[model samples]
Structure formats: C-alpha cells, structure tokens
Target: MSELTTVARPYARAAFELAVENNNIKAWSEMLSFAAEVVTNPTVEVILSSTKTAQELADLLINICDDKLDKRGQNLINLMAENGRLSVLPRVVELYADLVTEHNQEIDVIVVSAYALAKKQKEELSRSLEKRLARKVNLNCSIDKSLISGMVITAGDLVIDSTASGQLNRLSDTLQS
Candidate 1:
C-alpha cells in the first residue's frame, strides 16, 4: 500500500500541475476517476497485467476512455503505460482529488449518522463544519445503525465521535483506566 502510494505521488503531482496549468482541474479529475474505474474492471485488469505491448495497453485504455481524455490526458495514459505504472491509476485519482480539494479550498467530509439526516440538518451541519474547518465543506452523508444515535463526522484526519456507541466505548475505556 505504502509502496504504491510512494510510486504514485510523483505521477499524481505531475498530473495535478498540468491540470492547474491548463485550468482543467475538474476535467482531469473526471478523466482520472473514469480511468481508475476502468482499470478496476476484471477484464481490464487482466489486459493491463498481460504481456501486451505498452502501446496496445494504452490504446485500449484511451479508446475506452473516449473523449473523456483530451490530448494531455491521453499523453498521461501513454506515459503511465510506457513506464509500467498503470496500476497506480487508482492512487493517482485519489491524490488528484485531494489536490483539487486543496486547490479549491474545500474538504470532503463524511458524516455517519444513526439515521437519515433531514435536508435542514445537513445544511446546518455543513455550515457548522465550514465555520470550524475554515474551508468549503463537501459533505457525504450515510447512515450507520450501529452508531445507535447521533453522528460521527470525519474530515481528513479529524474525527468527531458523538455517537452513542462511541460515547459508551470512551466511558468504558475511562473506567478501565
């Protein structure tokens, strides 16, 4: 995992820089995401790991990608294929998304609640988080019944555990200590 990330960082940074220069961050993000998804398909994985020529592998990906990738995107694909780094597509997409969020002064936040949150509740939570994090908040909300009640809000490395189960665990730990 760490090795893949280490190998992917430079490629991701290069892609990000090119996107910034072209003012096409969103386009690059979409392209990388699509490419990542494509690579995850079992058939595509086999072809990628096969003894096919780099050009053949790149051509297959580029064809499947269609117009989602422009010239620069195609070049990126070709470069990765030629260098035998195509396996890092998923990590590249992840890092690219992180760069985009950082560039846009936004954060992707996950909120796991005991039940569905009302639209108003989501709005309030977004507002509160934006104020606290000092960045535009992009919320991805889901329900986790195991939480019992309340929610767990996660943004990058910060996790706020306000769920009943979380509280109980904390209390148990404290008592044990």
Candidate 2:
C-alpha cells in the first residue's frame, strides 16, 4: 500500500462505521463520491499540496464545493486538510465504499475470461458464487483472449484461477523448479 492508502485507512473506517451506525450508507457514499471528485481536481490538488495555510485551503475547498458538502462532509475534509492529507480523499472514498459493501454482506467479484459472458451466464455465475460464498455478489467481467480458455474469478483476497494461460505458467514454473 502507498502512503495515501495508509493515511486514508482510518478516515475510511471511521466514515464507514458512522454510515453503518446511522443506516445512511447511501448518503455517505454519495457524499464521499463528491468529495473524491473534488479532491482530485487540479485546483483542489494544488490546494492540498501547496504550502498555503490550512485555513486558506479549507476556505478554498468550502467555496469550491458551495452546497455540495454537508456539515459532516466538510468536517471530514477539514480534518484531512488540517493534517495535510487531503490528497488521500480519493483512496478514502474507495476504501469507505468497500467497507460499506462489506458491512452489508456484499462482495465484489472480478471475472476474467477468454470471451464475453452472456447475461444469462453472468447471472448464473453471480448466483452460484453468492450461494457458494453466502453473500451478495457484485460482478465485473472482462475478456482476456490470452487466457485461451477457462475463467479466473477474484473476490477480495481470494482468487480462483483456471485459465489455460495460468496453467501454462504454472507448468513452466514447475518444470523450471
């Protein structure tokens, strides 16, 4: 993980917990999405990294955001600005979303195969994976022709690799070893 990830971790966790406790995950997600976008803008990026005073940066942020950020959102941004870690907002938003979904007993899976999967096939795979993992599964799919055949499924820390390309690499490694 990078320094940005490290700095964003605690803020993400705190925001996620607040969202869950208040049963306002959607609202929090929306707020964070806006913050993430604003924080990545060129002007915001300059404000975050420049040697400007903390108050100056915070005012710039508030003025830029105008009506977009709520009190809670501004508070979080202020805290980050005070710490000179505003650049971490994007990472914080991403991790906050991950935490929110995890708290909701949902898992995101990335499926890689040699070809595009049909809608029926995707639905079936998602349902099967949900049953297998005992959680709601959100899926992202991609075609990787280099895989030759079979598919690779990634969910969180777990990965199931059954692609021909993976097998060939494994065979090569074994033979070399």
Error of 2 at 125 (Å): 1.4
User: Which residue ranges in model 1 land beyond 4 Å of their true spot?
Assistant: none
- The numbered model that scores best in lDDT is 1
TM, every model: 0.88, 0.91
lDDT per residue (tens digit) for residues 93-158 in model 2: 889988978888999999999989999999999999999999999999999998889999999888
- Candidate 2 ranges with C-alpha deviation above 4 Å: 172-177
TM-score of 1: 0.88
